[model samples]
Target: MKFSACLAALFGAVFVFLPAAAAPVDAGHARVELISERDAALPGETVYAALKMDLDDGWHVYWLNAGDAGLPPQVIAQPSSDIKAGAIGDIVWPLPHLLPVVEGEIMDYGYNHQVVFPFPITIPEDAMGPVTLDVVADYLICEDTCVPEQARVKLKLETDQAEANIREGELIGKWIAKSHVPFPGEARVLKKDLNWSLSLRLDGGFGKVRSIRFFPFGHDILHPAAQPVELGRHGATVSLSAADMTDVSKPLDGVVVIEQEDGARTGYEISAVEGPPLPDTSGLGPVGGVGIQVAAWKLILLAILGGLILNLMPCVLPVLSMKAFGMVSAVSSGHAGEVRRHGIWYTAGVLVSFGVLAAIIVALRAATGPITLGFQLQNAPVVAILALVMFAVGLWLMGMFELGTSLQNLGSGLADRDGDAGAFFTGVLAAVVGSPCVGPFLGAALGAVMGHSAPVVFTFFLAMGFGLALPFLVLSFVPNLYKLLPRPGKWMDTLKQFFAFPMFLTAAWLAKVLGDLAGSGAVAWTAAGAVAIAFAAWLWQREARLPRILAAVTLALTLFGVTERAMAPAPAIGASSAYAAKYEAEPWSASQVQSLIAEGRPIFIDFTASWCATCQVNKATTLKSKAVHDFFAANDVAFLVADFTRKDPAIAAELARHQRAGVPMYLWYPAGSDEPQVLPEILNQGLVTSLPVNP
Candidate 1:
């Protein structure tokens, strides 16, 4: 039914175009007119030829590059014997919009107005007195269906001396400038398997660059309809993946036209230079390049290692220790059979928890479609919520009223009777607690899963779960290990309470994380929630019914408070570029840098960040060193720090053109080279000393 309706709409549009073709050429409906300058002067003197079309309300014409399916208006000028025409410039296109014609196809064209096409003519010196120039033009005019239209225009004038009209000259010049395409600035290129990354820097107005389109000029280099990855920011970074990057070594030059959202189009020829080699990713995958086979093996291995490491994490450690203590107590009581049963139950619990997590991940991935690395981490709300949740969990561990199995006791006393179920839940709780600590080994594994197909991702996750469960599983079966544990006594109670401190510490860390995610208000709310929970726990232990009611009420209120804060619009944390002066090429120009150096301006080019791990490492190590500090003080280089912590569009654009998308992009304009010399990603004191100085 949808297809039928679409076809009907298409036919209806085609019918509307028929009447426009036969419409008479007149002032009110459709008209063809000519505007020109005819004069006999020196060869270098300029002459103008213009053809204007006054179309009816719904009629339209095509631009220079009609795009997909339209014909451009062609002009043939009949010049006098002495007059000669230079290279015919491209037609100045008014703004164009993507018009959806058929269901699947779209045409980029313009509509509904009087449009003109102008060409320049040069007159030779010692020309005749009278000059008559004739023009023959052909245009394909369309409304829905199209019809070809032709017209002959002529103009005659006499010129013996020079004459100039300021208005006419300005009007012609304005149109000519509009017709000329703009030049593209610096660009950096990175090669991927299927695409060559071209990062461009747009100059001029912030909002002026609306959409960018790349025309390869060569065939089969890029696939048709290969969408550019849109990084929406003032200084946006776009990724263009070519069909193959093997052919490109250095910069690949091509025409790039940017169309403003407000309907202005500017064209430029862009060259994308080769960027720095990709960073070391040895442990990320195989020793060689990232291929399907290597990535799969790496995922499996990392998952197992990560799972094994989880047992040692603060969150999971307490739970595992409790299980060990439980077994020791059972064995000391001469309940060997009970110890064995508890071990089996605990293993079951861990496996079941893993199963549930796998199911959730699989289900979510299926429902949402392919779980790409970018997609999984893209949602800001989700990230915020996860951070908040982790923080809350951390606080709970820090000695807040014990959660988890406390509620299980209320349902039916069945929870109290079921040791197996308790063990299972403990396993589940371990997994939940371990989530925040992604750990070194797990990061690469998880990243690979995010980038790969579903089967590979699932396999890796399963392997990781197996590794995590292995230690607990082995302990459960090994009766010797259970016997080896210290006998239960008064000391067991002391040890149990001692283990709680780690939970409390974990909670404090989580609270700080919450502060980072939601700000000071969230941290304050967390403190209040902790207090309320503690009071509720005390009441529950004293008067069971009273505690239950209070616990319910407090939980409700706390959740409401947390939810309100979480849902609130995120407050801006960083400065915006809108207030700063547009980075003109004045201060950083070669001459300016040289002059500033001569004047003894202390220049400290800081390549800093808010989230770069390497930058943080550098800041803590070399950059903060006293020697480096004293050197800066002694030399008096002007300190200028560029902080690229958040989503800074200008910084991103600048980085993109330089073939960098990550932080720690440093440049020291020590007064020459026309361009700033980019610093290496890693920094050292020696490198700083080597920088050019005007001694």
Candidate 2:
């Protein structure tokens, strides 16, 4: 149902092309020109033409459907008798930006710098002289105020020296791609009082919409009031306000720009007939109990706090400790410059890792419908690889072979190269290790950004990454904190060696998670792989060349065997759910939850994953405690487990509905309530049992 909003053929493969310019009319804040892709056309050939407007900085002009105020650029195209052309069709307008006129508090949509309004002109089959086309353009230019502008330009459709202008053709093609894509589904507008709701079926894969805004093609129908969107299952509803009841009665027509988390945007041209609004699958709005709406800034702050707390998580602590020590070593060495450099590079590494996570989100949203944090840990192969990686780090820490300083091992063998490379990779290692643990303040923050724009999600994650790196970064610049510690000696080496045991423990834990995903065979394979890694490292350090070659082969074989040997997860074991053995947690599904709700049973949903360290902690303590279990049994509360150990589209969608990117989301629904109360990311014993049974 992807439809092109333009009347002309605008779809083409991307290419690099130079631009061709013609003499233009200077209209104060705007420069206007009438140009064609072809310098001239044959009697039977069709040519594309456009009115190009280049505005001065901070200055702007209206789109074909200028909303609220201002006028669309008008092109009065009068072609010679030889040339066949329809009145300039819906001006192929590039998606516009929201500009608020402060003087009148009016919101106007238009172009800031440059825009191309394209139209197709076909030449007749009959013989004729050079086709002369005279064009008159009228537009409004506004900055702090407004100005009426006009331009008169002439072009010849046919000439002896006629040729295709590659530059102009490229320019036209570029703008066409930016123009509105037609609303592929039904568009309807329903009104209540002075407010109008425009419902559109926005397909998935738009990629974390930052904003879904509508700009009406007509005046009065859409006022300057804020247009807030409520994203739903298969579509979204935009709350629009007109100036009055009369204006609200008018049909809504214009472009809807769906801007994703990443700065990419898609503008859909929708024409809505007055009718019932589309079914609000999200159930958000006044009826759905304060919906999944939170201030973006609050989400961002929560992300930062969550990141800061991640360093203390068990999964990340071992690598982080080593990184901290390295920073201290640099400070104690009195190399202040090196310390700061290391900090910056380490932060960069963290930010870059988060960027990869962003890319994964884009991919997941396109393939599956919803995605959450720790998505990387869901793949059994990824878990196996992580286990191997942790084992290798353990071996390095135990001094099985020497690459560089003990500090370098923290970066997983990358830091040994004299530059701050070790510090950088150490940060990377910390992030990867930390991925399986969701810490305090992260769940709601990450969840809030799940269905939002890419830029927002990226910023939220970047803030979290910065928070994770902040402590080490601060220590690098502050030497006094390390001054209290004794100078580096044998004790430092002993401490480094002690940290290796944590890496080993972590490796063991990962193996267990891997076992949960695959079977005992997978665990056995990983253990054997671990042994092979240690042996290979030991052999590589030998002076003999044969031993080094043998070590390489052994390492290669181990990786292949470990990855390929794991069997498909056992279905009866419920590999996709969590904590079933510890407690009688039923597998969660939307339909089941609704059925339970209908039966008047209170519901508690534990959104968790096998690999998430935080999820495991809560499962062991708060969630499994007898007191909490007894409370639920007495209250007849249904305990549902939505395990995210592996990606499930239904689970993903549910997570998105709750505004979460990953697991450890604890939701509580009262017996008679439909909306589930989102618990803190970190669960506590008293917290779970304290809830009222009949409330």
Tens-digit per-residue lDDT, 303-373, candidate 2:
77888899889788878877866765676566678778888888888888887877776554433334567
- lDDT for 163 in candidate 2 is 70
Q: For residues 1-695, write the lDDT of model 1, one tens digit per residue.
A: 99999999999986533211122234333476655433233344666656667787667777655555667787666564223334333344543434334322333344457776667665545556645545556787777777788776654434565544344445555555555354434555555443444555445322434466665434324322323323221123344544443466546655565677676776565566777321111111111112233457867887888789867654466556656555565567666666666666766666665655556555543332112221211233333333444333334434444543565656765543455555665566565555434444663355345335556656775676677667766765677776677767888767656655555554565454444345677657666766665665555455467767877787678667665765454445433221111211122212233345545564544434432334545556666677676666676655455544333333433443343333455666554232456676567887776677542
C-alpha local distance difference test of each model: 0.51, 0.72
TM-score of each: 0.45, 0.58
Model 2 lDDT on a 0 to 1 scale: 0.72
Candidate number of the best TM-score: 2
C-alpha lDDT of residue 609 in model 2: 77
- List the RMSD of every prediction in angstroms: 19.5, 20.3
